[model samples]
Target: MAIDFVRSLRGHPVRPPASGIARRTSFWQRMHVDPWLLGMLLVLMCSGLAVLYSASGENVHVVTAQAIRFGVAWAVMLVLAQFSPATLMRWALPAYLAGLVMLVAVEILGDVGMGAQRWLVIPGVVRFQPSEMMKIAMPMMVAAWLSRHELPPNWRALAGCALLIALPVGLIARQPDLGTSLLVAAAAVFVILLAGLSWRFIGVMVALAGAALPLLWMNMHNYQRQRVLTFLDPESDPLGAGWNIIQSTTAIGSGGVWGKGWLEGTQSQLEFLPERHTDFIVAVLGEEFGLVGMLAFLLLYLLIVARGLWLAGAAQDTFGRLLGGGIMLTFFIYVFVNIGMVSGILPVVGVPLPLVSYGGTSSVTLMAGFGILMAVNAHRRLLPR
Candidate 1:
């Protein structure tokens, strides 16, 4: 099956060389399962399991749970990929509204974990981070809203879009999950940018954002501020706020050129690196596989991003293009922020490393985004005039 899929991707007709050969590409092709994209995702998931096993102190249970989560996420991706772009767009506004209601519910009656009220649990049923839904909903909402109007939206339209972006972002930030708020905000902004908002307005917004930094800093929680301070001078409080970064950098540096070998990272093995199974998993990868491994992982990520952008560009309608582009950019932000914080280049904001990190919410949310990307690609031909 894999061989035939690869051949089909390469533009060869899927045929048996002998007589009585049956072709099998139609279903997958109809479902819009881009072999390259699916292959990359599988590779990342496999590598994630390997790193996660080592990070979890060789815990079989942890790896099993992660594998199960990936299975669910993959199923979701396949199902979502089967939808046409128009079908997705039709659901956009409702999804956004439902997400907003969930966010509001969180504000009123959410569960607190790790000092943040970010999850809403239904009695004996399900619990999830509403903010994760925003990661997809914001872009879809913005894209749909913008698509209804003109290209290069005027200042009035931009203001409406800003309001659309701001509502959930503000709600998430109030939950004090700054990392997610920023990610959701960035996704919506990407949709606006792709919609061709005028450069003049963009410049003014940028300048305003620069000026607002001080005010934004003032509003941040003390711990958030401490993260920034710790990022600047981790040595200032080596035993306190700086411990995670110090250990992460140490793990990365000790890996040298070729790494210490799989499951042999002293930092993670010795339990010196915090969150080794989650946000700081990259450090585990760096320690176990070194620069070579990190680069290889990044190359896979690059291919996914490139393909996402290509799908966005190829999309026949404004909504598909904006939504696809937004998802791609948001995914990039997740990778950049995770790698940056792990490397001590960016302040810690608790953003997980997409698929490679051991987390259920982010994994599902990210894969769903990819599913939408696939939908955009697959359903482009069916887009309405």
Candidate 2:
């Protein structure tokens, strides 16, 4: 099969008709499938199912539903991986525009769920988060726009890109979903950083952000501010606003070195921990599998990040490099923020642990981003110098 693929790439005609067609199709299907990336994802998915079962109190139905979501996401990943980087670039602006429009639709016609207006429901047909689409579109749009010019973009270009990022981020934040908004903004920033923006400008922006912290604090909703305060002192209101963080930290700390073992964790099974199957699933992992399991999960995550960076570096074009790199960095942020929040090191925001949390939208959206990364890698060799 490998020989046949090489021959096809070299413009050699195959003599065996049936075998040639079958092999050619198989090769093409497998072409964009990065072994390391796929392997890591598989491991994470299996581990997620195991932990989710335990987190949900050994509920087979919960794990079964999550498995279905993973199946759909995996199919979407493979299908998306078939597109060439050029094809993805062509759709970048339109995709971003579409996401923005959906976000607007969400603001006006979106359904409220669990105290947030983030999902758009199309009557009886479909319901989904528009912000999830921005996870990919935002970075792609920024990369596409930046690729049109020289690296170390001018102030004007930076400003324009910031506006592009700000629009959806502003809208999503108004949904009061600080987590998704931060993720979207970070993804765009990764593109800008990869595009070689000026360090002086970055420093100035950071300083301005620091200066505006007070104003930002003042503008935050009461619940949002309470989260920050709870992060600083979870003991201040241990049975009230701090219950989630306190319970999470206890679950993590009680696990000691080797964990309580599988479904034996008292905190999660007893319903002491909050969001055991979603945002705080890592705490369940920690309590059940201990520090060793957490370390192993981090290793797999790091390998995925490393492979993504390698692919981004190997890409032959600016768009591929920026888009691929941005996706990888944003993925890293997802892991870091989720782990930090679970361990009580950061304010609790509703960022789910990628691939390891029992959620449909986030899992699907993340897998699709990897699909784009695979597309970038698979098409790199086809590009001319």
State residue 211's C-alpha deviation in candidate 1, in Å: 0.3
lDDT of 2 by residue, 94-208 (tens): 9999999999999999999989999998888778999999999999999999999878898788889989988999999999898899899999999999887677888998999
Candidate 1 residues 1-385, lDDT tens each? 5676678789998766566765444666777877788888899899889999999999999999999999999999999999988899999999999999999999999999989999999889777898999999999988998898888887688888889988999999999999999999999999988888677878989999999999999999999999999999999999999999999999998998899999999999999999999999999999989999999999999998998899789988788999999999989989999999999999999999989898888889999999999988888744322
Q: What is the lDDT of every predicted structure here?
A: 0.91, 0.90
Worst 10 residues of 1 by lDDT: 17-26
Instruction: Count residue pairs with overlapping backbones in model 1.
Output: 0
Question: Which is the leading candidate under lDDT?
Answer: 1
Question: Compared to the true structure, candidate 1 yields what TM-score?
Answer: 0.92
Q: Which stretches of candidate 2 lie above 4 Å from their native place?
A: 1-30
TM-score of 2: 0.92
